[model samples]
Target: MPRIGVYNGFDPVDVCSYCIEVLKVTAMGRASLRAMPLTHLKAYLSAYGLRGPSHAVEKEDYVRAVLDARQSNGCLPRVNEDYYRRHSIPQPTGERPKGFLARMAESFSDFVDSLPQPDLSSHAPPPPPLPPRQTAPRPPPRTTANRPPPSMPPRPQATPGPSNSRPAPQPTQSNPPRQSNPPPPPPSTQRPTPQPLPIDNLLTMKPEELSALSIGVLKAILQHHHVRIPQDALEKRDLVDRVATLVEAARAEKEREARARAAEEEAELEAQRQALEEIERKKKAAAQKDDTGASEGQASQEEIPVAVPKAAAHAAAKLERDGLCVICQDEDANIAIVDCGHLCLCLGCSELVMQSSKECPLCRTRIVTSQRLLRIFKT
Candidate 1:
């Protein structure tokens, strides 16, 4: 069957087919394996009872896996010379074969072989044999006659002094034992100096932490941060206290600044709110004023009293005339004597009339008591 993964339009299939057809196998016989599509290689692997190339990312990996399986298990089918001969079909020789260069090479070789050959035995004589190598005679052994004299003369030994005259042997002196410089003052019990703390950390250090530092370290820190150190701060505790006080003051100042900023922001917000309220109140008042002005204009236009007809005017006049006291018309006749029921006296006139005489004007009856009139009107 045609290669299983062949697809006419797909780029991967096209590429794989191109590789397999155009590329020659490498010396290691892995070019075909590497060129084959991943799917085709994976399919071949299944027949050999090997795992697919699912784990193999690169072409080399696939090639390696295939090579390992093929060599080790010999599971993949192979075609030998006999297999090819058995399967090969003979084609009819209609015209001459296509290999013109092979035909030409064969003809040239036959022509060369058919030509006369040169005989070297009769043409040239053999070269003369080389003479036997002569060995040189040996030289005589080195003797005293051949030896040369020394370059310098040897010196003579000094004569020994008389045995009694020899100087007495000097006494052998013994060296006194060395005093090994007292064991280096027992390495004074000094601890390693600590590295200086960072300025930021020093600024934030607590009282206890400050107390742990040496007075010199504390002073150095204060100098680095440009803090004014008190002259009396000689002791370690005093330095620690000074540092602590500075830290607290800095923290408090920071907090105060933050609070002040927050208060300023709040004040700004409150002012904005009040301004908005004032704007709204002004809008409402202006609206109400507009409404009031409209109402006043309408009132000015419509509030004129309608002229009364003569009859209504006469009736109103008669009513008013009747309401006044007959004695003195200055005040309204709001009081009436009870027994007589005469409505003629004003409140002031009623008192005077009661004091003068307990009598009604029209009936002339004695007035037992008086009551004020309250008029009622229904629209």
Candidate 2:
């Protein structure tokens, strides 16, 4: 008889189905009821409250599996790309809500209020104000010659001081009556002088973002306050900061790129050095071959004392033998720079080689004609 076996391959851990059902119900808290399938809709019913614990776990696991499969299959919907950004979901870790619904409602209200109101595209413009009417000028009142002068009250007299032992006497004074016509208001002292804005200072402001403000409002506000920045200044300030930051970032990035390029050049130089070493190794190998292959008649145990570096040996010999510029071999030497040798064909080579390149092909010394080079041999 064949042995009985449980389900095979990708066997999920056994979980109570009843427990899963309850979990599925909770996890589906925000799922749209209208779009949910009939079978899922039936399972979500509150009638399942009386179900057993094992059944709930199993249902949750099943729902979890379904969601997992969908996600793995690359079909999961993106509900909130911007929802969880740098500052989104600012809740602290290791926290649990006392009540979920209340929190949700409050968060939702705050988020909704944060959005700007829609423009009223249908509103009509207000009519322009009416013009003022013209009025006739009134004539000044005529003065009467027979009019009696008004009586005037006497100014208050100072109270007399009493003797040291005598009691002080008290006197009563009535309060002044209020007048209907008040004294003419003090003359206006304000000067209507128009001041020119310092174009140099205002030019420092980010003009790109200034288009939002009216010229009148900008000029008025810029006046009377030089340091206290307005809230709208943030809009302009952000652009300035952005440009500055971009420039800084660009500089940093350029420096980084330059460093990378320099590192690459250094690596390339090292490779070239290795290649030259290899070439020298090959040359030494060839020289050894030539020495070994020499016939007995031509070969001598006492080798000729030739300079190891053939090129430098030639220059040393030429300077010693000729006592002149090896190039022109001119006995008459003149026109020299300090430290550098005065060996050249003529004044033409002196100008061309000295001024044009200034580098000696032999030692690679940079020669400055004005600085002058020493004549090791006067010739």
Candidate 3:
């Protein structure tokens, strides 16, 4: 077949590398198991299959989760053979592995053992105690004391010593400022008002969930919180629709920002890609560039000599000799290179890879997202 030359914007494989780098796995969290090589992860998965080694997988995931968090920024390294060898630990096979691979596995295991485990504290609340039995009220105490009685006076003949001076000026108390004895409210001063807690509104919340939601989230929650509304309550429908629309728009905006961030990181990492070195190797490419073109009275804009196809091929062969993939292998099965040549599988494997790693799988060259994905086959 004739050698097909494609000059496009970016390579898919390189893009994938960007993605991988952004998605760093090392920081993904080391299992509490310790600094285990990443290889044992495969073994762990293999051993458990369906019902998992909860502890092991959890440990791995914990670390991977951390890495995943950073992947969005393309700051993570690619998961390649080296990565697997460097990070993975082998599980204990009943009969130990023999030879170099076996020894390597053992070493990896040591690394895992070196990882720290999360402390599993028993902080869960104890079960509720049985209700106390009702008790009868106690009677007042009867004190025993000898007492003297009777000093009786003769009954006073009706009414004299009358209204002695207006009943001794009716005794009065300067009532201390009427004590404001209001009941103390519950501990949390931030309890939602009962008005906002209509049966309908409360229902939408998670069962017994006190969502500390923002105003926008709150409005969205309201739409679904209430149970049933009357047919004629068009206002409810309108409000719900409005809130839903607003929420969707906000979520979309957030996602766009996240992707943009990832893209930026991918670009930075790509700028450091090694593939550009091919440009330095080619004399023809160098000759194509007119260093004095600027002073030569620029006819139209002068174009610089980019790396040539032959040089790129030689770079690829060299990288292969060093055991590197021709293109940056993003996590995806496929990869892509742009303009200078090639594409991975049909899907935008390059883009996906870019999201994960910074290095190309094939040439192990550093790459950027600005490189175009020219649809051409890799030799």
> Which candidate leads in lDDT?
1
Q: How many clashes does the backbone of model 1 have?
A: 0
Candidates in order, TM-scores: namely 0.24, 0.18, 0.18
C-alpha lDDT score of every prediction, in listed order: 0.54, 0.44, 0.43
Residue-by-residue lDDT tens digits, candidate 1, 1-379: 1233654331333423222321122123676566666555543443234565577667777678767644232323353223323432124387644332233345557879999888777745555455455455688876667557667885644765575254554544455556688665665777655455664576576667778887667776554333456677666787777567656655664565466556556656655666776678657756776778766754553455444455444434433333667788655564555465666765467667767876777778876643322211111
- Tens-digit lDDT track of model 3 for 292-321: 444444323235444445544443443332
| Winning candidate number (TM-score) | 1
Model 3 Cα RMSD, 1 decimal: 40.2
Better of 1 and 3 by TM-score: 1
**lDDT of each residue in 180-231, candidate 2, tens digit only:** 8988999999865545344334444554544454444453433322212335
